[model samples]
Target: MTRRVSAIYFLPLVLAAGFLCFFLDQKINASAAPAGFENIPGRILGSAGEAVGDTLFLKADAYFHGGETFPNRPPETKEELGREGFVEDERENEKTLPAQPAGDWISRVNHEVRRHGHYHLTKDKQKEMLPFFAAAVKLDPRNVPAILTAAFWLDKSFDRSDAAIEILKQGARDNPEAWEIDAALADIYFYRKKDYARGEFHYADALRKAKSGDLTRFRRIDLTYHLAESLNFEGKRALALEAYREAFSLYDVENQTPLKETIRGKIQSLVVGE
Candidate 1:
């Protein structure tokens, strides 16, 4: 059986959906929003206008400000950034968070709604909130959480898997090195599209592109282990074994002997035709 990875590893779409619900309530029922909530996009736009010549900085800023003002800069894709060897500032590396200003907006809104005892949202309300997330992605192609959470809700909540896949594909192209987007695409292919081969391919790509410094050791192990699972799903037993071995090597157990032994047992099972 395929190991069902915890939703904790998946994008936190429940919290994301809650955030979107708060925003949707504010947009639909103006009284639900703070006094200047409507002006946020405009404020973000005005700030973007001041960042004209610095395309990279603008992209980074747009990522921080919800991307409402700027058009998608095609030439400045993350792939291009990788090609240009654009290293993020050490300060940026220190601030570890999946960057998404619109999602931040949603988070703040959701928190206020919950504080006021008005957090529950209907299905209809969730449906109404979809467009806002889509628009956020349109504004900022690098909005990882916006793309992920929007796609998650669109597919799971709205039965719009095709739309979700399209969003993820675009996100993959835009953020070429983003293993999270690739992993999500792999999952969508396996579960939603039922394309095991494509799923395996993406999982492999995610594993190949993953850098040890960028991703946590456990996350790296998970990626490799899941790649093995994908290969197994595709009936590539040998590749699966190799992946399991890779996963085992990636794990830095130290005092975590139980997990180390568990992975060892997994490797043994694969080797002995389990």
Candidate 2:
């Protein structure tokens, strides 16, 4: 069974021009704040020049459309997929995706991943989504799903590990004791940012939280292995061995033979010369 720390939903695409036109119409016509709201700096007061509202709207457009005038995304060729290290796009070819009007928070988020998830598998297209993801998080800071998805894209697609770290840090602050966020941060620090010290800290915290919280046995095993990997990368071979042993101890007896053997190999490798 595949395990996911964060859940993602997918959707199809629609006519870009029509979609944006409808979205902008709805947003502009939506009720504005009481009168003096215009006096507030950076307010979206409909009296827009290059105000924050307009800027953000334009930014959102770029985010959604990737600056393309047409909603034309050419299907990937077999060779292209191979070169990009991707498999086939398995989604149904539908012209119109579900409607996710602005402020329909959950629906909008669903639209985000469904619209952009496949693009995220590639380098250039994935980088194009940075603004969109950031905007989504800014719109809903407590949305852990959006935070995790965005940070994952930033780190993996754009090679912007620092940006990913910042996003995850905000998520950690908002959702304190969320092992998923901390665990994700630990992975990024260790693998992407190459900040092993910070990785160790977050990994340890994830372990403590996971043990005390309602984390699944599978998730606990997964985190333990990750912690061991971090320790190994930091050259703490002895500590890594201990972590691997603990992980092996936690595996389900009926279905963990392969995992146990893998952990055993890792432990033996660590202790070979010591």
- The most accurate candidate by lDDT is 2
TM-score of 2: 0.56
The segments of candidate 1 whose C-alpha lies over 4 angstroms from its true place after superposition are: 1-115, 118-120, 253-266
lDDT of 2 by residue, 171-216 (tens): 7876786777899999998877788878888988988876455688
lDDT (Cα, tens digit) per residue for candidate 1, span 1-274 = 7898788965687789889988985675564222245445423454352233134333334443234223321223344334422332222212232232345778867645532210223455456555566556555566677678778878888889899989888878768888788888887888888887888888888877877677887777777777777787788888888988988887665646665676688779878995
C-alpha RMSD (angstroms) for model 1: 23.1
**93: Cα error in model 2, Å:** 14
Candidate 2 stretches greater than 4 Å from native? 1-123, 211-214, 256-259, 271-274
> What shift in Å separates residue 205 of candidate 1 from its native position after superposition?
1.6
Clashes (backbone N, CA, C under 3 Å), per candidate, total 0, 1
Q: TM-score for each prediction?
A: 0.54, 0.56
Best by TM-score: 2
The predictions' CA RMSDs to the true structure, in order, are: 23.1, 18.5
